[model samples]
Target: MADEIKPAAQQQVQIPVDVSNRETVYANFVQAHLNADEVYLELGQFSQVVTPTGPDPIVLSHRVIMNFVTAKRLADLLRRAVSQHEQMFGVVEVDPNRRLRVQQPPV
Candidate 1:
């Protein structure tokens, strides 16, 4: 008897994910630092406040360190996700001032 061959997509195996002890953190801001080999992504919440002193501070919550290859993959995944979301709803505004203006009520 001859064995049947499958296509590339069909040959792919599904990997099970375990999220039993995952801690979820909400980060409105992220800072990236890179060295010779690895990249450090610091996720934090930005406190928007206008002061005479200087710019607002970001309280960091989580820090994820990954290699360059993994970082590129993560970037691609994020881009795809944002594209899908925009297609379903509308274009997301990245400018904070523009967003605030859109949300303002008419006098």
Candidate 2:
């Protein structure tokens, strides 16, 4: 008699994660380039110029490349996390005008 194969949901798979020499990076700016199968992410920090003439310079700190599946998973996780944060505290807006007003002198 042959044994029946169990479905993926019924089977338990243990995935190991190694973080022995993990590098941590702090990025205020993230740029994502996506293709048909993969996603390229550039993580960096933006330095504000003394004069508000042009855009700030972005210094790339790290780059992460992942498949579409992993990228989608990460997006879902970030969405859930941000939603929870907003619920706990308040909504976070990325309005440049708000920061500009603080930096600029009274007119």
Candidate 3:
């Protein structure tokens, strides 16, 4: 009895997410910056100025700052999600010009 090992009880911890006060913002632009210890993500939307001669502006909506480890984990999670989405649907084209070309009919 003295030399017998006892198994510890396994418990599952539940983490609750509160979305009551959550606000959603759409972002078509993302700029990433990093320092010695942290990563900064600036989410924004691209809007065209009234004039056709000027470059479009990116209106920053939100910024997320996290450590390198969290950033790497997020990158992996995003990759997996995108892979799953591509598998279910099709390859997502990031280039707008290419997408337009693919949608065009042969002349």
lDDT top scorer: 1
Q: Write the per-residue lDDT of candidate 3 for residues 43-95, one digit (tens) a residue.
A: 99987455666777679989999999999999999999999999999898998
RMSD (Cα, Å) for all candidates, in order, is: 5.3, 5.4, 3.5
Off by over 4 Å in 1: 1-16, 49-56, 103-107
Q: What residue runs in model 3 are displaced by over 4 Å at the alpha carbon?
A: 1-11, 48-50, 103-107
Which residue window of length 10 is worst by lDDT in model 2? 97-106
Model 2 per-residue lDDT tens digits across residues 4-76: 9876676668999999999988888999998888999999998766556787778998989999899989999
Residue-pair clashes per candidate, as listed? Answer: 0, 0, 0
State residue 25's C-alpha deviation in candidate 1, in Å.
0.6
Q: Is candidate 1 or candidate 3 better by TM-score?
A: 3
lDDT of each: 0.91, 0.86, 0.90
lDDT of 1 by residue, 1-107 (tens): 89898766746679999999999889999999999999999999988886999768779989999999999999999999999999999889998788778465679
lDDT of 1 at 66: 100
- Decide which is better by lDDT, 2 or 3: 3
What TM-score number comes out for model 3?
0.75
Q: Looking at candidate 3, what is the lDDT of residue 98?
A: 84
Model 1 lDDT vs. the true structure?
Answer: 0.91
